[model samples]
Target: MIKNFTVFKRKLSHVCNLKPYKDTKWLMPNGNPTGLFVYNCVADQKVPVILSDPHIATWYSCGPTVYDSAHIGHASCYVKLDIVQRILKSFFNIKLVTAMGVTDIDDKIIKRGKETNTNFKSIAQQYEYEFWLDMANLNVEKPSIIARVSDHILSIEQFIKKIIDSDMAYVTPDGSVYFNTAKFPSYGKLQKMQDCGEPLSVLKRNKMDFALWKGPKPGEPSWPVSWGEGRPGWHIECSAMVSKLFGSQLDFHAGGVDLQFPHHENEEAQSCAFHNTLQWANYWIHVGHLSVKGDSKMSKSLKNTISIPELLDKYSADTFRMACLMSNYRYPMEYSDQMMQTAEETLKKFKFFLKDVYVYVNNNALQNGVYKDKLLDDLQNVEYQNLKFLKSDFDTASCINNLLSLMSNTNNIIKEKNGEYYPVPIILIADYVTTVLMKFGVTLKENTEDSVSNSIIDTLVDFRHTVRLNALTRKDKELLNACDIVRDKMKMIEVQINDSNKTASWVFTK
Candidate 1:
């Protein structure tokens, strides 16, 4: 069963050290707009939100189409959103209800199913299962709700009917239903379509026309609705789902920035029209796209996309997650083997430092005494800074980097032996860091076996010593082979230990 941490409240204050924004801020320190505008009618008007409630936040993220394997771009968006949710919970003692809707009824799914000579439902199921596996490998927490479009056909139909009844949507000569951009009048606000160089009318019937319900084509999935056999449009799925899952008014709505234009804009129109409310979402957050080889777009047709499963298999999930965190959530990230290598090295260093701290804590506990207040204060300060960084627009990349710096500083302090024995504070810091890391989906298992832990450390130290000895004696081939063998053995042992520890933790918790 999934554990619920909603009822727990921390004693610490949730406020951050940074000055809160009183008005909409266009440019962040990195020159990117921290504020987003939602298109209510057809015109995009900038709306400012009040951030009074720090303890309650709800977020909705556009989930995968589930027709194929998830790529690095998909993984990037999820990681970014996960970081945002984590920050909200850790900093403000907030309980976030995050929903990620799976697009199980997309046109792409039907086409892919036909191409693969399989049933659409089967295809969607297979891909959705694969998505969950990928997410688990990456250590991503499951969303509060994993809603499927197929399961919400009734809600979609009712929502479409309501829009039709309200005259915001009309049926075409064919069975297709499109939202009347002329009715909304304030369309194209989110993406500033009118401000773009091209004439806004070129894209649709009016400046912001988009499909709400697509008429069924031969062999496509459809449901019996007011409009003959038809399916909900891409935008309508989100509008319907969000409204059904989290009332008409939501705390936050988020997706990739690429969806700002027709997708999210249309969703806003449909939602507001159906609910007769101006506030569709209190806050709109969009993650920047992920790039390949420094290019801003990565598509499967180009065959340049990287799959999450493939990346996880090549490097550990921790490395893949670390790479995503290296780039700010609002900035496009460039993926490369070099970046993955850097992330892997950084994770290795963190794990090494953590293991050292764990060993010291356990050894010090053998000679028991009261915890040191100074070390506790230092750890608490680091925790405070982490919360502060995260609460300020979910700046997890910066927060994690700062955490690594703290880990380095803590290691140095231990090395210097500047304080008396007070292992509880260090242990608490390690525990806190481990918890936060888990929230980011970094895999950090507790070490229960003293002998196994010592052996692993000894083997690593011995390998380092062997490298020095080999360098001095000029036995290059022997050193290389020995290092490879030792590394492989250590990996196998670590896997076994982790599996055992997971079982033990589960049993103990139960």
Candidate 2:
């Protein structure tokens, strides 16, 4: 493993020195993004993500509001983003530095606190903890930096001051601040709105203006500024955090598609105005919404959300991850019992196929066979090369289809050879499948592991058989179920069971 790690590092170093891909043309079977392309929400088209620096990429993702429990909708957004990040680092070899902001101070938090008779900060902290726990259960990777609104109040104040100083924002008489939409001509460019259809607030100068700071209300949390005490608005927190971390510009800005209008548009306007740059971020990536039945979005307020913990209790994290991967990132995914069932069955079939390959490799030694099937080999190479193109385009759904095709061809070869074919190509297919799936966070558990000796497994099997016989003689359903439970549990320890008419046998899979 150490030698392999050293070799991988050396290869990566060599790849860094090589010229980058000029277009959507891959470097052969290597899955480096011919050019990393992600859908830019404002541009409304897929744009290539080029690193400003040599090997590092900078990204900012809008995080949860942290006022309540995170649900499957949150899981869908974060897991899809996690998949993109993994591909960039592992396949594209681009080091990513990402920042996600937690809206720890918000109107929702204050409202919830008033209802529950808890402090707003306490409510925010509790939900924030729950949010991270949900992320872990779903196997969503954490961002490089987690900036909370409460932690960056000073920076946000400075940022608002900068916007006010630039004459793009103004301070209200009550110490509130508002972004002057008329001053910035490209204010609605992100949303591509021809008319500012947003309803006008009483204190704003124009109907299109949005709040930059909220003046203090009775019993609400407030931060002191030069004018008076107030809290940062939703849009300003993100702009402040992004500017603090990535400075003038970043490679990508990402969040759910719902944020594209108003939230994202407002963020873009303020960030660009603050930095005095034409663009605050080079590209924007938005994950499609996950909805419940019909057109209703899976949201907390709708009372239609499936929490991450609730889903994980019924299915494995990898199953849910695969469910997300089975759909295009830019498309909405419907969450249903049927969708989850399909995902579970699909994952199980893939795992069983991988287990068969592992069993064959263990039973037979590597050798060259006289009967070489040209079609199978050709299909294998073709599918392998196709992955580079599919993944480079951020077409993970098609990449999965590419893998399924490879697995089907390999299985056909295995059946035709009747367990007597060359092992080299077969193992290569297994390795390739494993590598692709690992990038998606679905690890195959067919690999060898440290386990008990063969004798110990034999002893356990004999004991289980004895119990089964006793239960059979007594016709006890409870005892019989217990015997079955033991057999099923053995699989967790890398033991396989084969049942006969009157008895069961076991083998050490490791």
Candidate 3:
């Protein structure tokens, strides 16, 4: 019956080890290793991860509320998660499908709407567009799906109905539906609520209980549901969307650590109730918060936030990405102009090394065998260390340090080359170095046309040297005239380079 059986042959795949291990390379080198949360299905008593096979691994991130433009703190979470997705694909060789949900309906959205004297939908759309622009400027990839709550009201209602039918949720006298906290015993497991003080909310029967849907209020976004004209609460939006898009079980759900509490906890409760199971996700990954000026957390309401667009306008996106990677994903990063300046200087060194390697490789007179194998070996080691650090729970800081070490070694090797140079293999090394920097979103490409023009000027200086030698030896007026012409061009190119560099410096300083 099966004629071409060879066409249907299955390839063997490696199984992922799930056993927990201590991460000695954490931020402080010996800090308590972060733990992963896995949801166990009550019905089958097994974790609900997809069977080991070829399929798109799903990741859902809690996106920003569109009431305000995104800031560096918001960008930090997205950048860390972006690296996670990249490593999953590059290192583990896994297929990934990621999604982010915008909170278009929330108390904050309504408050912002009233404050701005605009309709809720208009306010949401305007900020949502601006958010997309900011993400574009920062070069953050768009999620596979960007579902807005306003676009999925019916799905939200269906999810609520399922939970209500399961006796896990109930509508109060005001038509607000609340999840029964006592129904789920593992409600506070993610954040280890027992160790923390009691929750602050006293509105619910249980201190851990949170809203599933809020009753309608005047001048607020509302949807006609079975309960009443109201909207989904902050936590329920993510739960409802995740369940609708990826079903009740997901491979990974991520957000900032600040969300592990009421946000993710409530999502777990609502999803588990709907599925009649204990697990909502296979792995819960939370990126650490970004700090500004010492250890103070950056917040918009606190007026200590840095806008993404504003930062990009000042510094290259590559510099910003480098600064973010300088800190571990799960640890706090203190942001300062001095840090960014340091990142810029570091990037310049990397660029210079890359160009030198390129020039050495392209030189026809250079011999090849001297540093080729050593450079290749060093590059491979860097890639290995990067994977090791990332697999140990996305230890970006250590991974970056390893990369820097490789770069330093490669630079030394290039510097020590005094014999016949092989330009081809050296160019290959430069290409490899550039690719590695690109993985972290750092570009060695000069930022302006003027910089490119200045490099041309530097090359012309060598040409002028040749021309002057010809003029002196042969007494050629043509060669002398050509030297003068090149001198004028060099001056013009130098001026352009100086002006561009000054502009870049001023932008960052301000």
Candidate 4:
């Protein structure tokens, strides 16, 4: 028998066996229902997620352990979460108070301590700084709080005390404390299994039971505690941080799928045990893995992990971000030369489309006020279309694809003769592209220039465009010859000029 739920506190929106509906007070404004759902790893289905408060959301993401440099595999998780937060804030209009816990004191950090012949704290900080720098480079949104376990030791100790007082945790003879999983009853539901990994120490009551606090180990960092001079276990750090930071519950708990087992499962068990609630986090959001071309997983043991610094050295961060967004967040994304090359090429294409639009819109600014085109009229309710895509479980890839397709047609208008060249439609199409790109950590730069030389070039290009457009219908040989002279002269300075119908565009190929 698989015991799925246990007795718990308040009426959670979507937790354990209880599924609140349209009438539930927690849904939205006066409990009005809305189209919101998540592919919950816990429920293993697309469960409706109605936050305790629609306007304000409390989210927590499990951060790096900080023992080693972050890999691209690590980038995949954080970037995906960043995009999720952006959509929640932008499209869903949710004000987010997001927290990410950094595991600065862990077994991995201790191992690095021995290797470096230094205290674990320094080693953890060194890599933590590097990890965050990489995150910034990748355009990941900064978390509202970066909670380090070492900094929150007091709160962690107090958390352990509460669990102990609840009788769900026991202090062993060695002064280490362990959460008795047998007491929680719904302990295995997150990972959806009953059998746990082999006990880390024989002091634990059951093989499934995990440590709330570990006893002092030789050469490892330790803090003075009532139970013992030791650090909190990996699982307990996240659990305690969630409580100390966001009370006993969260709207969302996010991490890689690898954490679903002993890490997240143990956190879920400890949370419910400490709070006496069957549901702790309302929604469990997990990101899939980033695999190499030939490998199934990127692992240090397998000698296959690709570091972030290595990737950043070769490709632009935006290209890598594009790859992440194009791939489904729920599925595994393979890192390959072909995949990355495709991403680089894709970004270049978007750059090219924008380049043409910028030149045509700004140069023809005066005439565009009266000029109208049927193709431009076809792009209707783009905001509505984008929002509709967002409402459907945030299919961001499709949202991007929609813009790309629209731009493809828009680009056709720019490229082909008799195609429309107007500012409003160009702005309309670019607006859609820019809106989606912002969600993916991409910014479309519109730098202002006031240089006299630039103004001269802009005026010259506008003159060439005007004359060539006039020459097209007038059938004046002398005016056509003047257009050719301007084109030839611009080309001499490495500028490429092309004429399609009434529009003459020039680009500095150099």
Candidate 5:
């Protein structure tokens, strides 16, 4: 393990170089963007994400607003990010400090509150709980710090005050505060905005200027303020949370590409201004948007979004994660029935393969066979390759391909061995595959239907044996009926029954 980790650390400089490097960032399988283009604070613009410390990484991701149930679009974004996190922790072995900020107080929350006739706080809490349950179901790693926008009001107020004092922000006659985009020259750099693209907010002098704080309003969630009673703006929540959690800077900041605009851009602007730092985060990472029917982005306006809970009802969490990862993170995911069905099938393949291994090892793999040396050689070869792949970026996709190949070869090997040879090699291969997959939070259990069928067959076989004893002693016509019942039951399950006058036996239909 030490040697394996060292091998990765040595290869790390090639990707996350501290010195400047420049290369065109291309989406490997397609000619698409990898969501956020690779940029580094140190050397080359071609570099993916270079850690600020170049040792351990500090990451901040903009979490959900939690006003309503999460959809497949949400799952795609989070799953891609979760895959990155898994790679970081499992392969790189870096000490990662990840912070995800949730906007528990927002306009959406208020609107949801009114619609549900529930308090905004209750709505936020309910959805927040739902969000986490869905995240956990999809195997997303929980953040080290969960900063609710509402919880960081004091910090946000202090941050806005500093920017205002610095003349980087301004307060309007209505007591609402706004970030002075005009005061910050490179204000829209993250968004690449050349001109104001939308209608102007009344509080700001410029269209690009965004709200820092809105003054008091009746029947709305707000915090006390000398400027007026109001809650933090959408962007400021993240800036304040990141500031409180990791000082002013982050090694990397991630979110869906949609956030690259005003949300992340605004967060970037306020952070740089408030911290007196050029760029608050070293790397800006993003995931691609998910579309429904490959037609439009999943939004409430179209009413085409599929909620996570809704999808989970038909497919497992692993299925969703698999489908999301099936496409590169940079490419948009189309929520097509075809994609889900494919993912479901892929999941079954993995589960079926795992169950086969489990049964073989428990039932047939008991022999201390003669092919120990050959088994050791094969296991060692695969282990080394798997570890090497785990250490490299863009290697995970290939890793899956390799596993499929191994499964194919193992199936042939099992047939040739006929349960006679060493099971060590097979055991080792399955263990390695499973361990590596678990990094992505893909857990495989024995095939449910197969397990259930086996259990039922066992019970039926025992019951038939007892019934045959009574029927035999009586020598009655019911003897044939009793045997017929067992045969019919077995046939229903596709289990072929073979009966002798003295006993009954069964095997799966060919």
Candidate 6:
């Protein structure tokens, strides 16, 4: 893990001699020339994601507010972010240390607690648990650090105090602290909005100024700060947590595009003011919204959500992940019946092709074939395209499209030889495809109940193969129909059968 800064620095010293390529800013730790460009929300253009230490990249992503069950819109953002993280760690070999903050102490939690007559902490905890479970089901990897505002209130207070000491923040008459946006020259750098330079008002220092600490409210959580008893504000929680974990600077800060205007902009302002630096984070990455019919963004507040559990009940996690992959990570993804149906069909196609190739390669022997050179060339080309698309802001849609083309081309070439595939090249293609898909959170295997079930399935496949062979020899059409019935029955249990003239094979259809 990249969590230990000492170990990271020790490793960085050895790789200092390796430099980035002349044409591109990004470089592999091994000094290989590679590139990864991401659209920086702050910069308003795609920029190279270069590693300062030649390997490690520090990232801070805003996490769920944890007042209710997460929805597909949340799923879209997390799954896509996980995809990018997978590529950075698995494909690019970048040592990524990601810290995600859970907004457990928010106004929503308080409001829900009051409505339900429950403890606010209990509400946050229950939903926080569900949130992690949902992420687990969606195959989102855990961040290097999971910071909750409740766990770091003291740090938050200290962070706010530092800003006040710097004279960029002021304490209100009600014992609340607000960030003085007018004092920060580059306050709206993230949103590219110019400061109004407005004078102080009776209620607030400026109209654009936001609270860093809200005075303690009855029935709400609060901690003692230097100024008074208060709770950390929404934007201040992320900034404080991020600064505590990653120090004065980090490589990346990411969240939903909806946060670009005030939330992320406020976070950037206070963080930069706290650090006394022009830049707190080098790259700002924002994921677009996930919308439903009527162009309404799916959100809990809108009551237009399909909860993670509800969505997973109708479709596998991989299906939802595939739906996300089919769309660009930086654009709105429409979650419609047609989108899900298309994702299911596409996943089925890939699964079927993989099953066919796996059976062929397993039962056959490796040998030279006429199209070996052609197939190899095709593999290299598709692999190149996969990397190219993924490197350019994680264009997973193009990567998946290219994989579809590879599958089609490979299937056609194998069919040309009457199922006589060259085992070596065929296995190579299968391995590569599986690797890429797995990185994208697509598990190709069905979750069988136990080893006994797997053994039974294997035995049944062999038994069916023998029975079919006997029927073919005896010229019994009735027995052939019985075999077909058995195969259809297997489909009910999510097992697929692939039959050849002499033998048959089976794979789980998850």
Poorest 10 consecutive residues of model 1 by lDDT?
A: 501-510
TM-score of 4: 0.81
- Clash pairs, candidate 5, are 19-43, 20-43, 20-44, 21-43, 21-44
Q: Rank the candidates by TM-score, best first.
A: 6, 4, 2, 3, 5, 1
Better of 1 and 2 by lDDT: 2
**How does residue 418 of candidate 2 score in lDDT?**
40
Tell me the whole-model lDDT of each prediction, alpha carbons only.
0.68, 0.76, 0.67, 0.75, 0.71, 0.82
- Candidate 4 achieves a global lDDT of 0.75
lDDT (10s digit) by residue, model 6, range 1-510: 245645654455355432323322222222222367777765565665656665788999999998988999999999989988888888888899999999999898999999999999999999999999999998899999999999998899899999999999999888789898889866676676765434556869588988899988876778887898978889999999999998988788888999887888888889989898777777778898999988668876677889888998778888888888999888988888899989988888788678778666666545544348777889999999889888888889998899899888887755554555576787788889899999887887665556438778878988998899899899899998999999999988878887766346676655
Which one is best on lDDT? 6
Please, what are the lDDT tens digits per residue for candidate 3 over residues 1-85?
Answer: 2233233221101122222212110001111112211222221111223322334577899998988888999888887787777
Model number with the top TM-score: 6
Which runs of model 6 end up more than 4 angstroms from their true locations? 1-34, 194-201, 364-371, 417-421, 448-489, 496-509
TM-score per candidate, chains pooled: 0.76, 0.81, 0.79, 0.81, 0.77, 0.85
Q: Give the better candidate number (2 or 3) by lDDT.
A: 2
Error of 3 at 73 (Å): 1.1
Candidate 3 is scored at a TM of 0.79
TM-score of 5: 0.77
Candidate 6 TM-score to native: 0.85
lDDT of 2 by residue, 47-153 (tens): 44555453687889999998889989989999999988887787777789989999999999999999999999999999999999899877788889999999999
Higher-TM-score candidate of 3 and 6: 6
- Candidate 2, residue 428: how far the Cα is off, in Å: 0.7
As for candidate 1, its clashing pairs are: 41-186, 41-187, 42-186, 42-187, 43-186, 43-187, 44-189
Model 1 lDDT, full chain set:
0.68
Between prediction 5 and prediction 6, the one with superior TM-score is 6
- Candidate 4's C-alpha runs over 4 A off are 1-34, 199-201, 363-378, 445-510
Question: lDDT of model 3 at residue 421?
Answer: 49
